[model samples]
Target: MIITSAKLFEEILAILKDEDNIFVIGCNVCAAKLRTGGEPEVLEMCRRLEESGKHVVGWTLPTAACSIRSFESLVEKNEKINEAFCILVMGCGSGVSSVANVAEVPVYGSNDTLSLGGSSGGKLLSEQCVMCGNCTIGEFGGLCPKAQCPKGLLNGPCGGAVDGKCEVARVNDCVWTLIYERLKKIKRLDLLYVIHAPQEHGFK
Candidate 1:
Protein backbone atom coordinates (compact mmCIF):
# COMPACT_ATOMS: atom_id res chain seq x y z
CA MET A 1 0.00 0.00 0.00
CA ILE A 2 1.03 3.61 -0.50
CA ILE A 3 2.02 5.02 2.91
CA THR A 4 1.52 8.72 3.56
CA SER A 5 1.30 11.30 6.36
CA ALA A 6 -0.72 14.47 6.54
CA LYS A 7 1.22 17.72 6.13
CA LEU A 8 1.38 20.08 9.10
CA PHE A 9 -1.59 22.44 9.41
CA GLU A 10 0.73 25.44 9.38
CA GLU A 11 2.41 24.28 6.18
CA ILE A 12 -0.96 23.73 4.48
CA LEU A 13 -2.27 27.08 5.65
CA ALA A 14 0.87 28.79 4.39
CA ILE A 15 0.52 27.21 0.95
CA LEU A 16 -3.11 28.36 0.68
CA LYS A 17 -2.48 31.82 2.13
CA ASP A 18 -3.38 33.70 -1.05
CA GLU A 19 -5.97 31.15 -2.23
CA ASP A 20 -9.69 31.56 -1.47
CA ASN A 21 -12.30 29.14 -2.85
CA ILE A 22 -11.13 25.55 -2.36
CA PHE A 23 -12.59 22.21 -3.36
CA VAL A 24 -11.35 19.38 -1.17
CA ILE A 25 -10.77 15.90 -2.56
CA GLY A 26 -9.80 12.73 -0.72
CA CYS A 27 -9.01 9.08 -1.43
CA ASN A 28 -10.90 6.09 -0.03
CA VAL A 29 -8.30 3.39 -0.67
CA CYS A 30 -4.69 3.55 0.51
CA ALA A 31 -4.94 7.09 1.81
CA ALA A 32 -8.17 6.14 3.55
CA LYS A 33 -6.58 3.08 5.12
CA LEU A 34 -3.65 5.22 6.31
CA ARG A 35 -6.14 7.80 7.67
CA THR A 36 -4.43 10.56 5.71
CA GLY A 37 -7.31 11.18 3.36
CA GLY A 38 -10.50 9.39 4.34
CA GLU A 39 -14.12 10.50 4.82
CA PRO A 40 -13.50 11.66 8.41
CA GLU A 41 -10.26 13.33 7.42
CA VAL A 42 -11.95 15.12 4.55
CA LEU A 43 -14.71 16.39 6.84
CA GLU A 44 -12.16 17.50 9.42
CA MET A 45 -10.08 19.26 6.77
CA CYS A 46 -13.12 21.03 5.34
CA ARG A 47 -14.08 22.23 8.81
CA ARG A 48 -10.52 23.35 9.58
CA LEU A 49 -10.13 25.15 6.25
CA GLU A 50 -13.37 27.00 6.86
CA GLU A 51 -12.18 27.83 10.38
CA SER A 52 -8.96 29.22 8.90
CA GLY A 53 -11.00 31.75 6.93
CA LYS A 54 -11.01 29.97 3.53
CA HIS A 55 -14.27 29.38 1.74
CA VAL A 56 -14.55 25.65 1.20
CA VAL A 57 -16.55 25.28 -1.99
CA GLY A 58 -17.15 21.53 -1.58
CA TRP A 59 -15.49 18.16 -0.96
CA THR A 60 -15.60 14.67 -2.52
CA LEU A 61 -14.04 11.36 -1.61
CA PRO A 62 -13.13 9.07 -4.50
CA THR A 63 -12.42 5.41 -3.89
CA ALA A 64 -8.81 5.28 -5.16
CA ALA A 65 -8.05 8.68 -6.59
CA CYS A 66 -5.10 7.08 -8.41
CA SER A 67 -7.46 5.09 -10.62
CA ILE A 68 -8.11 7.29 -13.64
CA ARG A 69 -11.33 5.60 -14.75
CA SER A 70 -12.89 5.56 -11.27
CA PHE A 71 -11.89 9.14 -10.39
CA GLU A 72 -13.34 10.49 -13.64
CA SER A 73 -16.78 9.26 -12.65
CA LEU A 74 -16.46 10.87 -9.22
CA VAL A 75 -15.36 14.13 -10.84
CA GLU A 76 -18.30 14.05 -13.24
CA LYS A 77 -20.77 13.86 -10.34
CA ASN A 78 -19.08 16.56 -8.20
CA GLU A 79 -20.28 19.77 -9.83
CA LYS A 80 -18.82 21.78 -6.93
CA ILE A 81 -15.38 21.30 -8.53
CA ASN A 82 -16.26 23.97 -11.07
CA GLU A 83 -16.83 26.55 -8.38
CA ALA A 84 -13.38 25.94 -6.86
CA PHE A 85 -10.60 28.38 -7.61
CA CYS A 86 -8.18 25.73 -6.37
CA ILE A 87 -8.27 22.13 -5.16
CA LEU A 88 -6.80 20.75 -1.93
CA VAL A 89 -6.10 17.04 -2.37
CA MET A 90 -5.96 15.12 0.92
CA GLY A 91 -4.26 12.07 -0.57
CA CYS A 92 -0.92 10.78 -1.85
CA GLY A 93 1.18 12.46 -4.54
CA SER A 94 -0.32 10.15 -7.15
CA GLY A 95 -3.80 11.23 -6.10
CA VAL A 96 -2.76 14.86 -6.42
CA SER A 97 -1.36 14.13 -9.89
CA SER A 98 -4.55 12.33 -10.88
CA VAL A 99 -6.65 15.33 -9.85
CA ALA A 100 -4.27 17.68 -11.63
CA ASN A 101 -4.52 15.65 -14.84
CA VAL A 102 -8.27 16.29 -15.07
CA ALA A 103 -8.54 19.57 -13.13
CA GLU A 104 -8.12 22.97 -14.80
CA VAL A 105 -7.63 24.85 -11.53
CA PRO A 106 -4.46 24.72 -9.45
CA VAL A 107 -4.18 21.49 -7.47
CA TYR A 108 -2.34 20.99 -4.15
CA GLY A 109 -1.41 18.01 -1.98
CA SER A 110 -2.08 17.92 1.76
CA ASN A 111 -0.07 14.76 2.46
CA ASP A 112 3.38 13.40 1.75
CA THR A 113 3.64 9.80 0.57
CA LEU A 114 6.36 7.96 2.49
CA SER A 115 6.87 4.62 0.78
CA LEU A 116 5.43 1.42 -0.66
CA GLY A 117 4.56 -0.29 2.61
CA GLY A 118 2.14 -2.69 4.31
CA SER A 119 0.76 -3.52 7.76
CA SER A 120 -0.22 -6.70 9.55
CA GLY A 121 -0.89 -5.01 12.89
CA GLY A 122 -3.59 -2.32 12.85
CA LYS A 123 -2.45 1.20 11.82
CA LEU A 124 1.21 0.18 11.95
CA LEU A 125 2.92 -0.18 8.58
CA SER A 126 6.56 -0.39 7.52
CA GLU A 127 8.30 0.16 4.23
CA GLN A 128 8.83 -3.09 2.32
CA CYS A 129 9.51 -1.88 -1.21
CA VAL A 130 11.36 1.20 -2.41
CA MET A 131 9.52 1.19 -5.76
CA CYS A 132 12.79 1.07 -7.70
CA GLY A 133 10.82 -0.17 -10.82
CA ASN A 134 12.98 -3.29 -11.22
CA CYS A 135 11.94 -5.63 -8.43
CA THR A 136 14.50 -8.19 -7.18
CA ILE A 137 12.68 -9.63 -4.17
CA GLY A 138 12.75 -13.16 -5.62
CA GLU A 139 16.51 -13.30 -5.10
CA PHE A 140 16.45 -12.34 -1.41
CA GLY A 141 13.56 -14.59 -0.38
CA GLY A 142 11.08 -11.65 -0.77
CA LEU A 143 12.92 -9.28 1.57
CA CYS A 144 14.10 -6.11 -0.18
CA PRO A 145 17.57 -4.96 0.80
CA LYS A 146 17.09 -1.61 -0.89
CA ALA A 147 14.08 -0.91 1.29
CA GLN A 148 15.14 -2.50 4.58
CA CYS A 149 18.85 -1.80 4.53
CA PRO A 150 19.79 1.66 5.78
CA LYS A 151 22.61 1.86 3.24
CA GLY A 152 20.43 0.37 0.47
CA LEU A 153 23.00 -2.39 -0.01
CA LEU A 154 21.90 -4.75 -2.80
CA ASN A 155 24.70 -7.36 -2.64
CA GLY A 156 24.95 -8.24 1.06
CA PRO A 157 25.77 -6.90 4.51
CA CYS A 158 28.41 -4.21 4.87
CA GLY A 159 30.07 -6.21 7.69
CA GLY A 160 28.41 -3.78 10.08
CA ALA A 161 25.82 -6.12 11.56
CA VAL A 162 26.44 -7.38 15.10
CA ASP A 163 24.43 -10.22 16.62
CA GLY A 164 21.89 -10.01 13.74
CA LYS A 165 21.18 -6.36 14.51
CA CYS A 166 21.68 -3.57 12.01
CA GLU A 167 24.53 -1.16 12.67
CA VAL A 168 22.57 1.88 11.54
CA ALA A 169 19.29 1.18 13.32
CA ARG A 170 20.30 -0.74 16.44
CA VAL A 171 16.72 -1.56 17.31
CA ASN A 172 16.10 -3.29 13.97
CA ASP A 173 17.46 -6.58 12.74
CA CYS A 174 20.09 -6.39 10.01
CA VAL A 175 18.22 -6.80 6.72
CA TRP A 176 21.01 -8.91 5.24
CA THR A 177 21.00 -11.14 8.31
CA LEU A 178 17.26 -11.60 7.88
CA ILE A 179 17.75 -12.32 4.19
CA TYR A 180 20.49 -14.86 4.98
CA GLU A 181 18.31 -16.69 7.47
CA ARG A 182 15.27 -16.61 5.18
CA LEU A 183 17.28 -17.86 2.20
CA LYS A 184 18.81 -20.60 4.33
CA LYS A 185 15.36 -21.66 5.44
CA ILE A 186 14.17 -21.99 1.82
CA LYS A 187 17.41 -23.81 0.79
CA ARG A 188 18.15 -21.04 -1.70
CA LEU A 189 21.38 -19.77 -0.07
CA ASP A 190 23.08 -20.06 -3.51
CA LEU A 191 21.28 -16.88 -4.63
CA LEU A 192 23.43 -14.76 -2.30
CA TYR A 193 26.58 -15.35 -4.36
CA VAL A 194 25.01 -13.78 -7.44
CA ILE A 195 25.84 -10.12 -8.07
CA HIS A 196 23.04 -7.59 -8.64
CA ALA A 197 23.44 -4.68 -11.02
CA PRO A 198 23.27 -1.11 -9.72
CA GLN A 199 19.80 0.38 -9.49
CA GLU A 200 18.69 2.60 -12.38
CA HIS A 201 16.75 5.41 -10.77
CA GLY A 202 13.99 7.26 -12.62
CA PHE A 203 15.40 10.58 -11.50
CA LYS A 204 18.99 11.87 -11.40
Candidate 2:
Protein backbone atom coordinates (compact mmCIF):
# COMPACT_ATOMS: atom_id res chain seq x y z
CA MET A 1 0.00 0.00 0.00
CA ILE A 2 1.10 3.59 -0.60
CA ILE A 3 0.95 5.76 2.51
CA THR A 4 -0.71 9.10 1.86
CA SER A 5 -1.80 12.24 3.74
CA ALA A 6 -4.39 14.79 2.76
CA LYS A 7 -3.26 18.18 1.56
CA LEU A 8 -4.43 21.26 3.44
CA PHE A 9 -7.87 22.38 2.32
CA GLU A 10 -6.48 25.86 1.77
CA GLU A 11 -3.80 24.48 -0.53
CA ILE A 12 -6.40 22.59 -2.55
CA LEU A 13 -8.57 25.68 -2.80
CA ALA A 14 -5.63 27.71 -4.03
CA ILE A 15 -4.80 25.14 -6.68
CA LEU A 16 -8.36 25.23 -7.97
CA LYS A 17 -8.78 28.97 -7.58
CA ASP A 18 -8.81 29.69 -11.33
CA GLU A 19 -11.07 26.77 -12.11
CA ASP A 20 -14.83 27.22 -11.79
CA ASN A 21 -16.33 23.87 -12.87
CA ILE A 22 -14.67 20.88 -11.22
CA PHE A 23 -14.88 17.11 -11.29
CA VAL A 24 -13.67 15.16 -8.26
CA ILE A 25 -12.06 11.76 -8.37
CA GLY A 26 -11.22 9.37 -5.53
CA CYS A 27 -9.54 6.02 -5.08
CA ASN A 28 -11.33 3.17 -3.32
CA VAL A 29 -8.33 1.05 -2.39
CA CYS A 30 -5.14 2.52 -0.91
CA ALA A 31 -6.44 6.06 -0.54
CA ALA A 32 -9.70 4.73 0.85
CA LYS A 33 -7.99 2.53 3.43
CA LEU A 34 -6.02 5.57 4.62
CA ARG A 35 -9.16 7.78 4.53
CA THR A 36 -7.34 10.30 2.37
CA GLY A 37 -9.34 9.85 -0.84
CA GLY A 38 -12.29 7.66 0.07
CA GLU A 39 -15.99 8.11 -0.78
CA PRO A 40 -16.65 10.21 2.33
CA GLU A 41 -13.65 12.39 1.69
CA VAL A 42 -14.63 12.87 -1.95
CA LEU A 43 -18.12 13.94 -0.96
CA GLU A 44 -16.69 16.33 1.59
CA MET A 45 -14.46 17.79 -1.09
CA CYS A 46 -17.44 18.34 -3.36
CA ARG A 47 -19.34 20.10 -0.58
CA ARG A 48 -16.39 22.33 0.14
CA LEU A 49 -15.92 23.14 -3.53
CA GLU A 50 -19.56 24.14 -3.86
CA GLU A 51 -19.31 26.24 -0.73
CA SER A 52 -16.32 28.01 -2.24
CA GLY A 53 -18.40 28.87 -5.35
CA LYS A 54 -17.11 26.13 -7.64
CA HIS A 55 -19.54 24.02 -9.58
CA VAL A 56 -18.98 20.31 -9.00
CA VAL A 57 -20.22 18.72 -12.18
CA GLY A 58 -19.51 15.12 -11.09
CA TRP A 59 -17.45 12.80 -8.94
CA THR A 60 -16.27 9.22 -9.30
CA LEU A 61 -14.31 6.57 -7.40
CA PRO A 62 -12.00 4.06 -8.98
CA THR A 63 -10.72 0.97 -7.19
CA ALA A 64 -7.03 1.75 -7.61
CA ALA A 65 -5.93 4.94 -9.31
CA CYS A 66 -2.47 3.56 -9.94
CA SER A 67 -4.08 0.96 -12.11
CA ILE A 68 -4.53 3.27 -15.08
CA ARG A 69 -6.85 1.00 -17.01
CA SER A 70 -9.36 0.70 -14.19
CA PHE A 71 -9.45 4.47 -13.80
CA GLU A 72 -9.73 5.03 -17.54
CA SER A 73 -12.66 2.64 -17.86
CA LEU A 74 -14.64 4.32 -15.09
CA VAL A 75 -13.77 7.79 -16.35
CA GLU A 76 -15.02 7.03 -19.82
CA LYS A 77 -18.48 6.30 -18.41
CA ASN A 78 -18.92 9.52 -16.42
CA GLU A 79 -21.52 11.64 -18.25
CA LYS A 80 -21.03 14.87 -16.31
CA ILE A 81 -17.24 14.70 -16.50
CA ASN A 82 -17.21 16.66 -19.74
CA GLU A 83 -18.96 19.56 -18.03
CA ALA A 84 -16.08 20.13 -15.64
CA PHE A 85 -13.25 22.47 -16.63
CA CYS A 86 -10.77 20.65 -14.39
CA ILE A 87 -10.34 17.60 -12.17
CA LEU A 88 -9.47 17.35 -8.50
CA VAL A 89 -7.95 13.97 -7.63
CA MET A 90 -8.33 13.04 -3.97
CA GLY A 91 -5.65 10.40 -4.25
CA CYS A 92 -1.91 9.89 -4.71
CA GLY A 93 0.42 11.66 -7.12
CA SER A 94 0.28 8.73 -9.49
CA GLY A 95 -3.51 8.94 -9.50
CA VAL A 96 -3.40 12.61 -10.33
CA SER A 97 -1.00 11.88 -13.17
CA SER A 98 -3.17 9.03 -14.27
CA VAL A 99 -6.08 11.40 -14.70
CA ALA A 100 -3.89 13.87 -16.53
CA ASN A 101 -2.71 11.17 -18.87
CA VAL A 102 -6.13 9.77 -19.64
CA ALA A 103 -8.48 12.70 -19.25
CA GLU A 104 -8.83 15.72 -21.50
CA VAL A 105 -8.99 18.24 -18.62
CA PRO A 106 -6.38 19.47 -16.17
CA VAL A 107 -5.84 17.27 -13.09
CA TYR A 108 -4.68 18.11 -9.58
CA GLY A 109 -3.99 16.06 -6.45
CA SER A 110 -5.43 16.64 -2.97
CA ASN A 111 -3.18 14.10 -1.22
CA ASP A 112 0.54 13.67 -0.90
CA THR A 113 2.01 10.23 -1.43
CA LEU A 114 4.37 9.60 1.46
CA SER A 115 5.80 6.08 1.07
CA LEU A 116 5.27 2.51 0.05
CA GLY A 117 4.07 0.74 3.19
CA GLY A 118 1.69 -1.68 4.85
CA SER A 119 -0.56 -1.84 7.93
CA SER A 120 -1.17 -4.33 10.74
CA GLY A 121 -4.16 -4.89 13.02
CA GLY A 122 -6.03 -1.94 11.49
CA LYS A 123 -3.09 0.31 12.32
CA LEU A 124 -0.37 1.74 10.07
CA LEU A 125 2.92 -0.13 10.44
CA SER A 126 6.50 1.13 10.23
CA GLU A 127 7.35 -1.26 7.40
CA GLN A 128 8.09 0.50 4.09
CA CYS A 129 9.95 0.34 0.76
CA VAL A 130 11.95 3.35 -0.21
CA MET A 131 12.63 2.07 -3.76
CA CYS A 132 16.35 2.57 -3.36
CA GLY A 133 16.87 0.64 -6.64
CA ASN A 134 19.70 -1.47 -5.24
CA CYS A 135 18.52 -4.97 -4.43
CA THR A 136 19.40 -6.43 -0.98
CA ILE A 137 16.08 -7.58 0.43
CA GLY A 138 16.74 -11.28 -0.31
CA GLU A 139 19.60 -11.23 2.23
CA PHE A 140 17.27 -9.90 4.92
CA GLY A 141 14.56 -12.56 4.48
CA GLY A 142 12.56 -10.48 2.00
CA LEU A 143 12.66 -7.34 4.22
CA CYS A 144 14.69 -4.31 3.14
CA PRO A 145 16.69 -2.80 5.97
CA LYS A 146 17.34 0.26 3.80
CA ALA A 147 13.66 1.06 4.12
CA GLN A 148 12.46 -0.46 7.43
CA CYS A 149 15.33 0.69 9.61
CA PRO A 150 15.69 4.27 10.77
CA LYS A 151 19.46 4.05 10.47
CA GLY A 152 19.09 1.84 7.40
CA LEU A 153 21.33 -0.80 8.98
CA LEU A 154 22.36 -3.31 6.32
CA ASN A 155 24.55 -5.71 8.30
CA GLY A 156 22.56 -6.17 11.53
CA PRO A 157 20.75 -4.42 14.32
CA CYS A 158 22.60 -1.42 15.78
CA GLY A 159 22.38 -3.17 19.21
CA GLY A 160 20.29 -0.29 20.55
CA ALA A 161 16.95 -2.05 20.42
CA VAL A 162 15.39 -2.53 23.84
CA ASP A 163 12.86 -5.34 24.18
CA GLY A 164 12.62 -5.60 20.37
CA LYS A 165 11.44 -1.98 20.10
CA CYS A 166 13.29 0.44 17.82
CA GLU A 167 15.59 2.96 19.51
CA VAL A 168 14.57 5.75 17.16
CA ALA A 169 10.87 5.03 17.06
CA ARG A 170 10.24 3.25 20.35
CA VAL A 171 6.68 2.31 19.42
CA ASN A 172 7.87 0.40 16.34
CA ASP A 173 9.63 -2.96 16.24
CA CYS A 174 13.34 -3.03 15.48
CA VAL A 175 13.52 -3.86 11.80
CA TRP A 176 16.74 -5.81 12.02
CA THR A 177 15.26 -7.91 14.81
CA LEU A 178 12.28 -8.58 12.60
CA ILE A 179 14.70 -9.54 9.82
CA TYR A 180 16.55 -11.98 12.07
CA GLU A 181 13.29 -13.61 13.15
CA ARG A 182 12.18 -13.92 9.58
CA LEU A 183 15.53 -15.46 8.56
CA LYS A 184 15.33 -17.95 11.42
CA LYS A 185 11.79 -18.97 10.47
CA ILE A 186 12.86 -19.55 6.89
CA LYS A 187 15.98 -21.52 7.87
CA ARG A 188 18.17 -18.93 6.24
CA LEU A 189 20.08 -17.69 9.27
CA ASP A 190 23.32 -18.09 7.26
CA LEU A 191 22.40 -14.92 5.39
CA LEU A 192 23.50 -12.94 8.44
CA TYR A 193 27.09 -13.84 7.60
CA VAL A 194 26.76 -12.31 4.15
CA ILE A 195 28.26 -8.83 4.01
CA HIS A 196 26.44 -6.47 1.67
CA ALA A 197 28.03 -3.71 -0.39
CA PRO A 198 26.92 -0.12 0.11
CA GLN A 199 23.83 0.91 -1.81
CA GLU A 200 24.45 2.95 -4.94
CA HIS A 201 22.88 6.38 -4.51
CA GLY A 202 22.89 7.17 -8.23
CA PHE A 203 19.25 6.25 -8.59
CA LYS A 204 18.19 9.34 -6.70
Best by the TM-score measure: 1
lDDT of 1 by residue, 1-204 (tens): 899999998899999999989999989998898889999999999999999999999998887878756435755868787899999998889989988888778989999989888877665657798777778789999999989999888887999999999999999899999999999999999999999877767411
**Backbone clashes under 3 angstroms, per model:** 0, 0
- What digit string (tens of lDDT, one per residue) describes model 2 on residues 44-149? 9999989988899999888777766744485575878878889898888888888788888788999988888888788785347887776767879988888888
Residue 18's lDDT in candidate 1? 91
lDDT of 1 at 189: 96
What lDDT score is found at residue 114 in candidate 2?
88
Instruction: Supply candidate 1's per-residue lDDT for 169.
Output: 95
Residue 96 C-alpha lDDT in model 1: 91
